[model samples]
Target chain A: MDKSTQGRLEAAVEALIFASDVPVAASRIVAVIGEVMAEPAPDADAITQAVESLNARYDAQGHVLRIRHWAGGYRMTTTAEMAPLLEVFLRRERRRKLTLPLMETLAILCYRQPASRPDVSHVRGVDADYALRKLLDIGLVDVVGRSEAVGRPLLYGTTQRFLEEFGLPDLDALPNLRGIEELLSDPSFSQEKARLFMLQGLSGATEAEQP
Target chain B: MYRVKLRDFDGPLDLLLFLIQREELDIFDIPIARITDEYLTHVRRMEAVDLDGVADFLLLAAYLISIKVRMLLPKPAPEASDQETEDPRLALVERLLEYRRYKEAAERLATIQELRAALYTRGSASAPARAEPQEVLINASVYHLIRALRRVLTEAPEAPALVIRARDCTVEQQQQFVIKALTVGRDLEFSRLIRGRNRIFVITTFLAILELIQRGLVVLVSTAFDDDFVLALGASGG
Candidate 1:
């Protein structure tokens, strides 16, 4: 490809990541690029160079988002400089923060876990698929395995981050439900979940937590 | 007891909404029995598989059974002064509905992040770029698509009923597999290579991936859904 085409390709890749609300892997980017481009784009190296160049361009100077490699994908996110405006996107007023639902569902899972989605719905009296997805995206809950019963069900459990966020020493340290009242009062429970999760990450929890 | 991961979450309301929506029932009027069945189906599916994605969904199951029982059983009539008997789900459901609205707003705001990235070229244009979301609207509407996926999953081939036994898949094997495919075919879709393979092989596949990542021979990525990681042959080793 000519230099201009290559540059356009790079710009397109940057634009896609910028537009993505969440992180996506480079393979997804390559697939989208190939679909749009008439000729096969120059290899992934060129794409990587293009992304790196764009990242450097945004980082060296001031830019809205710097390309971040996250969750095994490339995504565009706001910089700390622009966090206030993004907070506006968060919209605290008149909004039932995610804390309530997330906490409610999380409480159900942590306590009555190895249960089913229906079991959770029965207890919480609402569908939890969305929360489940959000939880998955955040790296909080995970599938433990199938039930041994005639009708097996997926079991849910808390990660080390769950302990870290709650300021618990470990899963064993998870306090009993007696603190529900206190937990219900703290609206930041979900936000805290997100905060500690982002800080610690899904995989490197303890090492990152220790810091 | 492996830890649960929650990265795919939209919000808490999304979870409640999913429950309400699962039975293809109204959010206001819940068909407890059917809802329970569908809910359990999701749970059972999780129990059947060992993927991390199903963990939280399972824990919520028991709580669901409890609410169903409470709603089903006739309670002693509260005295005139007694607080009105609540629909056990009332508090939690309301919270879900409310959170759902904010979550939508968050999604909108999140999309703006995407537009800002795509439309603007920092320093090049004094003014910000306009957003482009024409085809973007064509996303799997989280609500409808999930139910549809659940329905389709019923028919998806039973991967295997026989061997739940864990295997010791070595990374060396996956590296060889990636190399094997690349050597055989010039190019391959990532999904095609990963599917129909043994579980033990996945570890090896991942090992091969990391090895290639280090050697600069192969690249792994997902095309659309984060469901599968696609591998593309890079030029370094080739």
Candidate 2:
């Protein structure tokens, strides 16, 4: 495309992202830009290129704002460097942090989504009712469906709000869940277990007596 | 007394992990006797404090003691290879390992949440509005009220010599009592509502309060201090 056309496309994408309260999907941007420009719809690649050029310009000019791909869409967000000032302005310091139980419950649902209350309780060895309720209140979790197991308990899953809050572009963006074999293979794990075994053999009774 | 609060640990597994980590004991070869004794000590202290969810801890303690007993029993002659006789600790070990994996995942998520908190989005500046600054009353959940009830029960003086009386009290009666009490006073502390009442009365009143909350006849609110909750009239109640 000509320089003028490329410039207009970039401007349109930037405007859509900036004007949107929530993240704007690439397809949505392409359709709007195509309809407004009265031409064939631009492909996803062109939208991506426009976003890249916009980011490049922002970086070259040291702009505080940049477009971020989040929750499967593009959103305009201030750079991380501005967090402190933004925190003060937003009073985000007062924001409640998820408690340990809540975090654990959320992690379980995130990895083993559509899980029942009993399933989560079995893993944590504690009733998850409170944590699950709190998560539902926070809009991070929701009842996705009922399980097929006996009694057909309600199954919980993470919500789009969860993805946006965690800054995940999609569930696929989640960090790879470490497997049991991987965890067991760590040298430190084996070494620690061995050392403890030896210690137990040496002074089992005395160690048990210690406060 | 250094009371062990429920909030100090996430759950029974967390307490077990703490015990294992603190003693540097091998998760694979857990010193069952030692861990069981130590776990019982923690659970006793937790019970003494009357913390909510101590039942879960006690359940783990029982499991540990059972494992310790199995370890002490003489093993029957192996019909085949040594692997035929399964270790009593195997199930527990697998459980601990699985819980540990989730705990690690939780930590990783915390890191991600922290990093995500640092990045500001377009609407980040306009956070949800806070409650009126003059009085900060938090909306209390059933969990919070349960904790408060535990505290009240702990502080309650023991009942005098038991008298055989007719058990006429019902949840409906307690509900009426709560409604009447609320009518007399604009707001009522849960502890005060059940104060000096018999155990049966306290329990029935609690159930009644829960029912009231469910039916939109009552609401539980608390200040920054969470030791207790206040019951106020709900929209329907008003």
Candidate 3:
């Protein structure tokens, strides 16, 4: 490709990503450019290179926003440094933090997709009805389908926004589950695990308080 | 008796795990009889506080008692001798282990969520518009109803049941009272409606509000969280 064509492709990629209200997949970018240019679409590699150059250009220009690769696509977002400014401009309130109960319930559903409400409640050792309802309301979880297990309760799974909000590219990006097993087998399991469970805001004397 | 706050007890499994860790007991070989005794003691404390959701803890307590009984009775040896007899605590231990794993996972995910909080995105304004309507209408509507009732109940005078008297007002009568109260031109504050009333009257008034809401006789407008809701007569009610 000539230098002019390469520059045009780079500009096209930047423009396409900027104009998109949602994340623009590489293939979608290629398809749009191909249809408009009335020529063969650039390969995924070329598009990726174009995006990389576009980002470099943005960095050199000290642009406040840059393209972010999230959930298998690219979208434009302001720098993390600009968060406070943007928040003030938007008059945004502090988003509600997930309560410990909701986080526990979400983790169970995340690791155990297609799990029923009873399955989740049994694991958490609490009735997850309210937590599940809140998660559904917040769009972090959805009733993916009904389980084949007895009673055929509705199966819940993490939604796409869960990945997007968590900055995960996909479910595969989740931390290794084996970490928990390793932590459990450690000699100082109780202390370390209790400290990790700061979700409840109780750090010390957790064991001493038990009957 | 050591009193565990209701909020501190995450659930039965959380309490049970705490007990096991505190005693340094093996999960695989729980001392069923002793743990059951300790667990029931904790349940007694929980009952003292009148915890709202003790059903799951009670269920676990019952299971622990059953396991203790099974341990007391001699079990028949397996005929094949190939498989060791299943421990009665096996199911409970498995569940505890599973729950512990997920709790750890939740901790890990919380860290990730914290990191993600640093990353801001566009469309916060439009996002809630799409997601809020259904949840706000169905869930928040009922939640606000309960909250409003609680607020009004606080203003109500303490229950004076010591002075025995015949029931003066029925739910239907209270419903009529609400209708008459809101029949005036302006909307009424929930706290105002129940203020200075006795407990029975306050409860009946709340029930009346619920009944009116159910029959579309009144509309509840809560301008902000935990604020007194304005009860307006619905068009149908008018």
Candidate 1 interface RMS: 14.4
What would the per-residue lDDT of candidate 2 be over residues B133-209, giving only the tens digit for each residue? 22223454335756887898889787879878767689999999998898889788998998887889989999999
- Candidate 3 overall lDDT versus native: 0.76
User: Which residue runs of candidate 1 sit more than 4 Å off their true CA positions?
Assistant: A1-211, B1-16, B119-238
Candidate 2 docking band = acceptable
Instruction: Name the DockQ score for candidate 1.
Output: 0.02
**Model 3: residues >4 Å from true position, as ranges?**
A56-62, A190-211, B1-6, B23-29, B75-84, B125-238
Candidate with the greatest lDDT versus the true structure: 2
My TM-score estimates for the predictions, one after another, are: 0.29, 0.70, 0.65
Candidate 1 lDDT over residue span B119-225, tens digit each: 21122233222231111123333345457668898887877868766667677767877888977875666667777877667657766777887897886544565
Docking class of 3: acceptable
Model 2, range A11-114, lDDT digits (tens) per residue? 99999999888888999998887787876678999999999999999999999988988888998988889888887887655445676788999998898888
What ranges in model 2 sit over 4 Å off? A192-211, B1-7, B80-84, B127-238
Error of 1 at B170 (Å): 26
Against the native chain B, each candidate's TM-score is: 0.43, 0.50, 0.50
Candidates by lDDT, descending order = 2, 3, 1
DockQ of each: 0.02, 0.32, 0.25
